[model samples]
Target: MDSILNPSTLKNLVFDLGDVIIPIDLTAPVRNFAMLANLPEDEVWAIWKEHNFINHYETGLLDDAAFRAEVRQLLKNDVWADEVIDTAWNTVLLDLPVERIARIQELKANHRLFLLSNTSPIHIRRVNDVLTQLNLPTLEQLFERVFYSYEVRLAKPSPDIYRHVLTEAGLVAEETAFFDDNAANIQAAAELGIQAVHVQPPMTIIDYVKDL
Candidate 1:
């Protein structure tokens, strides 16, 4: 509801991962692979939509295998199925930067932190690997807890997920601040009375929270 930075001086900070903490390469891997395999981009996206693969995977309804199998089935062409699955599933994941990681570390000193991400098993694994490679502190070091949509069975833009997180943390909406890249999701949280920050690129979330 309120966009004023630090309006509530929150005791808890909730973060969305993809496109917020980690950069996403939405087109490169999927598009390049589709072109190489001679599959139409529209058709591939059709499969993703049909199965609610993106939402389901993000919400934790589908595992990596199910995600892969669903895409393969959509192709209906056995020969190209595996390649299609690989590209569609792996293309969007990218790395986390050290500066951002440090910023998170800085925020830890002031807020009770938590992560709420709509992500799949595959990307979660990759993100953890990136975290390790960067030699950054473990996610546990930065946040009190981590909630994945897949594990929670609730995705963003769904009030239930936010309620669940608030309940789990024993926090009232007025005492918590949520950060996300999607406007719809921020609106959803606002509807539930949680302060929401619309994460924009080139603006550090740390700057959004640091004491003025």
Candidate 2:
């Protein structure tokens, strides 16, 4: 993986959604589901790991109804309604930091901004709804283009997803820079010649773009 000390020549900036732009508590959904099952959070997470509907849902292999059905069985009791199931499932998403949003908006003045995220319809709906509630612009409005894994049927850490975005957006690999919280995703993008930065936190994309 490579990091450009000076990103002056990069024409496009690609951002990963969760953690990079918006902070997420990965354990939140597990905790929420565990409450429903009367199981410990770790136990519910273990069950989730076994069934692994997360990857399937994010990759578009499962719809909301199918996902809820699978999750219901994890409870070992009566099924919960769609509203309850959705609210519980969406607990992983947290509020988007206003500072990060401002950083990206400033970056947009000089660079073509794009958002590429491994996300599901359910997750994105909650995000947009929150943005609406906050009187903030939606992701679509913030980015020149947004590539969602569920909509595209491709998820990252996969080179194919990176390639798909590049080709579809007519972006040159060398002229673009990508910021992601996931190392695998950063590596994949870097392998394709995009300037890639692994955003290790307590640090963020703002750290990379704040002075630019």
Best by TM-score: 2
Clashes of each: 3, 0
Work out the TM-score per prediction. 0.87, 0.95
Badly placed stretches (over 4 Å) of model 1 are 77-88
CA lDDT, every model vs. true structure: 0.75, 0.87
Q: Which residue segments of model 2 deviate by more than 4 Å?
A: none
Predicted structure 1: lDDT: 0.75
Best by lDDT: 2
lDDT of 1 by residue, 1-212 (tens): 33665544677888888787777887665575466557888766665567666777677677777766665566554555554565456668765667777877777777788998877777776677668877776665668999888898988888899999999889888778888888999999888878788887677666676562
Q: What lDDT score goes with residue 182 in model 1?
A: 85
**lDDT for 197 (candidate 2):** 88
Q: Return the clash pairs for model 1, or none.
A: 59-149, 59-150, 60-150
